[model samples]
Target: MDNNLEFKTIIKRSFLDNSKRQLIINSDYIQFEDKDLATDYFTKFLSSEIKDYRYGVRWIRGAKFTIGRDYQIFIRNNENKIIKINFKSFYGINKSLHFKNYSGILNSLLKFYFNKIASDFIEKFQNQLEFSICNVHFSDKNIMIETNSIIKKKQNTILWKDVRTKDYRTYFAIYSQENPANINQCYNYKDDWNTAILNTVIRTILKNKE
Candidate 1:
């Protein structure tokens, strides 16, 4: 465990409010609950319970409010009840420093994910098993996608070597080797869950391509 990644800090709830929120991250889980003040009161979500996670630089409520890495995790227990804790941004005026905090916490979550889940996916892919994330499906040799067109959607299979991925500010798109200028699949950063893992899995597999 990296000492730098484990730190807790309390930030004021709002501009004039005195209620403080303590944000902490460790190798096990990320804590966002402030027992008395936290609206969601999410104590924590362990790696096993987490179904999906997303973090990136994006707008929260509207255009004026921008939060870096919208830190959120989707989790469900054995009962299949879901829980999500929303992020609270810092006050305006020289608020950039808070991004470091977001990065640190997110990195810890990343470490937990990589150690617990990511390696499993990578190993499964290497073992030639089919798996799906979001709407895209991965096979031993190719990625199956539904290409979107003006007229209708069509299923397409592009080999691992021929597949290409594009990342925009708000969307992640996959392209085939056909160069048809059609999107094999497009996923919104907000709506699509676990995009970070999807992107990493693609890159790692492609890098070690045989």
Candidate 2:
């Protein structure tokens, strides 16, 4: 895919804030309470943004769910031509994958799903083109993708701001097919649909908590 075109597609999708769910450009994570909520979040998001696309294209991926919350993986492929894969999941209480056993369990899950997404994309694209991952994690607390590099950075740099909410607390991770570079790349556009969906989900979660 053309870098500029991919950037544009992401930017366009990111800037639409009226969307029920907010999209974090360069972020490879998402969180939701359950599959139904996750589906509703994405469906409402796409409905308000893309009129030509159908939400029913989503499928039941052959992956095991741990009984509580699982990320709903959505695949959009067209016979070795166009393939776009996305993932979304909700976070649960004490769902912290790491902080202690970061590498053994939490990181392992991250790496597994991340690689799963990449591998599936390769198969769908006939192992020809390089694809990216979009991950969303909806949690009140921040998640640390624990890494053990001594020369790593600590803080996150914000690139774009949400227009409606004007909040910049979200984090993003951008991965390439080959090299590892600056993952904190930010954008100027706001994904309205993502924000709306996220705001709705979070609000509901908080209400339930009360």
TM-score of each: 0.75, 0.19
**lDDT score for residue 43 of model 2:** 19
Question: lDDT tens string, model 1, 16-116?
Answer: 55666666666666665545643564467565666566555544565665533244444444355554433445444435655665566556667655445
> Residue 204 CA error for candidate 1 (Å)?
0.9
User: In candidate 1, what residue range of length 10 has the lowest lDDT sum?
Assistant: 67-76
Report how far off residue 45 is in candidate 1 (Å): 2.0
Q: After superposing candidate 1, which stretches have Cα over 4 Å from the reference?
A: 1-7, 11-13, 34-42, 60-92, 150-153
lDDT of 2 at 52: 14
Question: How many pairs of residues collide in model 2?
Answer: 31
